[model samples]
Target: MKLLSLLVAVALGERTLRPRGRNWVLGVGEQGPAARPPARLPAPTLSAPAVSAFADPAGALLAGLRRLLRGDPTPRCEMSRFVPLPAPASWARSLSPEASCPRALDGEWLMVSVSGRDLSLSSLLRKPAELQPEPVLITMATAVLTVLTHTPAPRIRLGQDAVLDLSFAYAPPTPEPAASLAPGPPPFGLEWRRQHLGKGHLLLAATPGLHGQVPAAQEGAVAFATWDDEPWGPWTGNGTFWLPAVRPFQEGTYLATVHLPYLQGQVALQLTVHKPPDVSLTPAPLVWATPGEAPPELLCLVSHFYPPEGLEVEWELQGGPEDGFQKATGEKWLSALHHHSDGSVSLSAHFRAAPVTTKHHGARYACRVRHQSLPTSGRRASVTVEVAGLSGPSLEDGVGLFLSAFLLLGLIRVLSGLVTDCDPQEKVTASTPPTF
Candidate 1:
């Protein structure tokens, strides 16, 4: 019975584990068909923070999920992606936050909230119809999400709470142009004349509102003659010039130019010349006295016609005779005497007597008179005087007489004292004794 039980156990075990033609089963009784290969799992997607250092894991995941469910297309999840959103309808109100708020749009809040949701990349790209392809918006939204999630946000200071106030500074503008200095009329017109009173006399005058200023001692501004084109006066002070006495030069019209300092233009005047009054000598033959032991007298008479009041006259002896006598011990000759008065002049010669005599026979003398009115025109006369006799005895004659008288007196005294004594001294003495 034990042998039979062993055989049956062996057969059951063989049935449980059967091997195919060349393959035999050892440990397990029978093996089903070879185990099929295990299925391959897909690679795990990276979290937002793991993929980009700047992304926020929770926010990025939420946004990606929201984008996937809303049939929105997923954008490049890289931090480098940037996009711009549509212009807000309330842009004007946003610009001025201090002012009153304006009305809101219908889907403005929904659109902004949807932009914050997370989305799966594949599911979000499946429906391109429901999702608008706005590359700029997607890029901008991704960039903003990335910065908000991974970077520390900066705080904005608004209104009066801000620390520093800013403004622009500028300078004031310049003024416009204007005129300067007061205006007036030009200088007054001037006029003048030249009169020839004498060789050295001149006169000038002007119309109203014109006067004469003294010329400089040095050469003043050059003056031109009205008639001729020549330059005149830069005259010295000695040259006589009178403004009130302006008259003509000769028998013709005279014109002159006068220059005053600080004057704008030359002064011109016209004058008519009139014939001057005639002057003559009363005693036609001007007689002169001869020079003698005593000075001789010279006399001359002059007469003037239509003589002006306060007419001044002067007399002078121009020259004397060519061979008039001269003394060895005194001046060669005496000058002719001169006499003058209101309108007439008398030329007189007076001899200053000296011890010496003079020979003045047939000596000629001249008398010259000058009138104040007619300075250039004057009268001159000459006369001849005869000087008689020769020179007197000299001092030598008196000396010779004195010497002769002295010699005669000496001879008489000598003869009286001497007597004719016969020769000896003894005989002279005896005669005197016998008489006594």
Candidate 2:
């Protein structure tokens, strides 16, 4: 009975102490339950002192931690587990020699020490711990450090092995595309009038229906391909072109094109070379005069299809062989001068002295007309002036003769002894006779 009771008690105790169904009980020699993994603790928050100590190597690590934290959706405690501490050497090098040790205690304050100098937890912990490693934090911290380090601040200690490793988040800058040239609306349907200037230049003037906006720059070289032309411009503000001289040997109409860079368009112009016209000058007959006779009235008439605005008329007397002659002026003369409106300029003047004696009679007088527009063209006329007998003398001529005679007599008296001379008187003989 006693044995039965004891056996029953042992069985009951085993059942009570063992785990529920499917549980395996290990004897003393059997292996124990697999060791439970060590409970993970949250990463320690670096105190101001520790942060200063680790600054040299910890900056990169802190930045990484910040990145990881920013990416993590978890709360602070969970995030700390994912962000592990950086390599000790990298952290140590980042820290200054005087900021070598830092500690966090009671989750409220950070104690810092450098070169045996103590810095209070409150003083170093002015900024929130979460702000560390952020861009703004580093900027602010550097500024604060600059101000603080100048004063009697704690010193940091660093070993030769310490190094700071930093990697910046950077991206290449994007490039912008160049601006396109903009040309405004072109004129509607209209035939353009083309006028030829010197060389390869053709002036395209706007006709009745044609209109054009002036280009920004006026001068430039044009480039044209068979199919298309584009103006690659460093255009000038003056719309002028200087081109090589064209040859007239070719018989066909030459097709030419120009690319206006500023206007961003191609222009077509045509040139036709032809022979020049025959040009000649012929003068009309002239009236004749004599010495002491009335001056011959001179008139010249020129005929041409186109007369330029800047025409100048000039006359020269035809003396034998000698080219010297006086330029005729509009001053008053012995005879009235007249220039008729029929394109003929005339002059009438009395000849005080005959230009040609009977010996050089029928000499030619030439008149020339010049202008700017007609460079290769001019008008010339010639007339003959002959000496003939004079008409009756006038009162003016008689008075002139009387004055001439009076002057001649006065000159003879002053220059010669004929008028002032007296006969030599005989010497008085009274003194000589008394002596005798």
Candidate 3:
């Protein structure tokens, strides 16, 4: 109990305090509404001049003015940041305008970023809110995307989504007492990136804006958390994603990467996808075969499997009530592999079963399969076999005897008729009378 409590306490950081009702503002020239510079915003909104979230607000404004000199729509620029409204000066400090962008915890936090920045723009403009310049292109280079591992880690289907939770509420930034008069850096999260998933990184957890969000909330004090004393920089968090519906061709190995500026630590992460097969047994072929003929055989059809290799099928037999199932080795042989258009594979297996016998009546035969995608015990199916061995000579054997006797009698009668024909044809006495 103590250990669990301690761990929780450590993970939770300082709970940020915020001013209620008012939203943060972004703009050029701090005056009128912009004149009121609060330490933090409850939930900030853009005023007018605060539309831009660039490091060089004044310079960006100057560039916008030049574009307006020629055309209303400014020259195209990339979306560099989605820094929360009323962004603290610390967010811009030591951070390059081109290096990365500020993203929210929730993957669906688009509305939050827009609303906050717009509120700040209104405030910064002070007068009638005018001249709103938005980013033309947003690169995913610094965008945090969804991170996915192999299914069956928790187990999911190929087309099923692997979703995650990465959401949180945080306090706005506050101006520091230092000479720079710059507000502290906004909270940031740790994220993971992959090779094929575009330039987006995977959101991890907690904010490191001022103090670590988790540690702050858990310990009830962000100031005294372990981050303060730790050699690595502040904590970061709020990341999530779900992969697009995957297909069979998409199954393979992948590499994942995460960037940590402070620690320079890298994780060797990889993912592999596998699809299991469906197995079935057929005993109908052996059901009607004569005992003296060919050996009884069972067929095991394996289909819809992946990688198209390392598949094996075995047959087992249980003869009589007292006998246990035994492997019918040397009798199992696999047929050629057949590839499916859907990127799956199939195989046929023939197992020569034991000869049918009266003692083996009511026996059971089973087909077991082994494959990379299957569990340790693998998959199997079975069917009961009933065999009453050949009893007496068949009807064909009796018919053979009857035909033999009839053929012998017919041969004797034909020989006697031949003898009578030879005597009559000679007629020696009739020849003598004619001579006298």
The candidate scoring highest on TM-score is 3
What's the lDDT for all of these models? 0.25, 0.26, 0.38
Off by over 4 Å in 2: 1-263, 266-283, 304-307, 320-360, 374-377, 389-436
Instruction: Identify the superior model by lDDT, candidate 1 or candidate 3.
Output: 3
- Number of the top lDDT candidate: 3
Worst 10 residues of 1 by lDDT: 1-10
Measured by C-alpha RMSD in angstroms, how accurate is candidate 3? 20.8
The candidate, 2 or 3, that scores higher on lDDT is 3
Residue-level lDDT for 316 in candidate 3: 76
lDDT of 2 by residue, 1-436 (tens): 0110000001111111111232211111011112222112222222222111112111222223333234433211110001112212221222222242222111122211111011100011112233345333121110000000111121111111111111111110112221343332211111112333433322232111223432222122221112111232111111122222322221122222111111111112233322221222222354455544444545444333122234455665666335456543322232233433422223322222244455435566665656442345455556665545333334566687899999998887776774334323323442355643
lDDT of 1 by residue, 1-436 (tens): 0110000001111112112232211111122112222111111221212110111111322333333334424222211111122212221112223233222111111001111122211100000113345442221011111111110111111111111110110110112121231222111212222334533222232221234343332111122212111122111111111222222222122222222211111111222222223333323243323344433444444443222233333333222332443321222232332322322223332222232224344434444445544456565555543343323333465577788788888877677556543446767667675543
- lDDT score for residue 127 of model 3: 12
TM-score of each: 0.19, 0.23, 0.41
Off by over 4 Å in 3: 1-95, 98-156, 163-236, 248-268, 320-322, 388-436
Question: What is the C-alpha lDDT profile of model 3 across 1-436, one tens digit per residue?
Answer: 0110000000011111122222112221233222333223222232332222212112212222232223322111111122223212232223223234333221211111111211101001111112324652211111121111212122334444443222211111112233443343233333333333344332222334434322112111111111222122112223333444445543322222212221111122233445688988886533543444434577888888876778777777776445887765436778888988767788988887645555555667778888877888889888766553344444565687788889988998999899877895477755765544
Model 2 per-residue lDDT at 269 = 25
